[model samples]
Target: MYRPLLRLLPALLVMLASASVLAEEVQVAVAANFTAPMKLIAADFEKDTGHKTVLSFGATGKFYAQITNGAPFDVFLAADTETPAKLEKEGAAVSGSSFTYATGRLVLWSAKPGVVDDKGAALLRGEFKHLAIAAPKLAPYGAAAIETMTKVGLLPSLEPKLVQGESIGQTFSMIASGNAELGFVALSQVFEDGKIKSGSAWVVPTNLHSPIRQDAVLLTRAKNNQAAVQLVAYLKTEKAKNVIRSFGYEP
Candidate 1:
């Protein structure tokens, strides 16, 4: 019996070795606005495929510059379609590897109740000392915020009171820390379970800006990486889509 058990142990060891070989660790550069949902999606993907995703989150424009300069990222999830498309054109990304993963919505959010209204009249009222928004040149949501303000005829008046964040995540942090009374942010950052989690928010209308089509692409460096390929495909799965939707993105 001891001899037979020993024989079985060898087979088990071989199986374990094969499983280890199948697992891959992938490095991903993700948009700051997609942080929460990406965390959930990464967890689910790892559980389902035994693959690991290491994430770096920041402004999409910065990621674009990094990828162009040979950053060691396997994939890029950008806040807007244009950057990914540009990467593809510049040969930094694999040709035809880009696709829209989610459509984002902009929202006016205030940590304090009643500070923001459904129609976003608060911006016109000049009630807040500092209004935080992402830097328009570096972030898609920031550009959208500017577009919204321009459409609503509030840009000039609000410009003086604006506080700029390098990324949407920082913008959210500012509002959460009470550094800014209210500001424009990705709807996903403040939304959960089909509702705004802890703040009064007004969903900005789409007509105010170009559709925020968030796209993902495979970097040319990841062309031969099976783990990177698998992770990209996993993002399109229904499980991942559900998580994205829960975050208020149209996935």
Candidate 2:
């Protein structure tokens, strides 16, 4: 028995070496709005494929600027389809490797349970002195919020009360910290288990603004990286779709 075990040790060592060689690390730039779901998905991706991920989250516009300036990201998960498309046109991303991964939903949320009503009438009521919103130029959710307010004819009157955060993450932080009584934010930020995790929110109707189509793409720098390719493929899998859905996104 000792002799047989000794003979198999060399083969087992070779197997371990091969496994280590095959595992690769991917660098991913994720949009701030998709933070929660992407964290879960990235973990699942690593566990399932034995690959590692290095994720960086930020505003989509800033990411776009960074990518153009040679950011070393292997993959990009953008808050809108336009950014990826622009990258593809500029030869900064792998052509034909882009796809919409999820459609985001916007919400009017307040940290306090009863501050916001089901129909989102709080804006009109003018009870809150300050309202937080992401910078429209930096975040798609902020643009949607602008559109919603404009369509509802509240922009002019509510302009003075608006407090702009550089990113949706910051906007959510302001509301959660009670710096702003309420704010427009990505539904994913406040939603979990098919409902709002805390506070009250009015799910903004999609018709009020353009559809927020989030896209994922393989960056040109990682064109030949196997792990990067696999990560993009993983985003399309049913397992990934389920995770996207759980965060109030339509996958």
Clashing pairs in 2: none
Across 141-204, the per-residue lDDT of candidate 1 in tens digits comes to: 9999999999989899999999999999999999999999999999999898899999799999
lDDT of 1 at 240: 91
lDDT of prediction 2: 0.95
TM-score of candidate 1 on Cα atoms, chains taken together:
0.98
RMSD of candidate 1 to the truth, in angstroms, is 0.9
Q: Which window of ten consecutive residues has the lowest lDDT sum in model 2?
A: 120-129
Q: Residues 108-149, candidate 2: write the lDDT tens digits.
A: 999999999999899899898899999999899899999999
Name the lDDT value of residue 211 in candidate 2.
Answer: 100
Report, for every candidate in turn, its global Cα lDDT versus the true structure.
Answer: 0.93, 0.95
Assess every candidate by TM-score.
0.98, 0.97
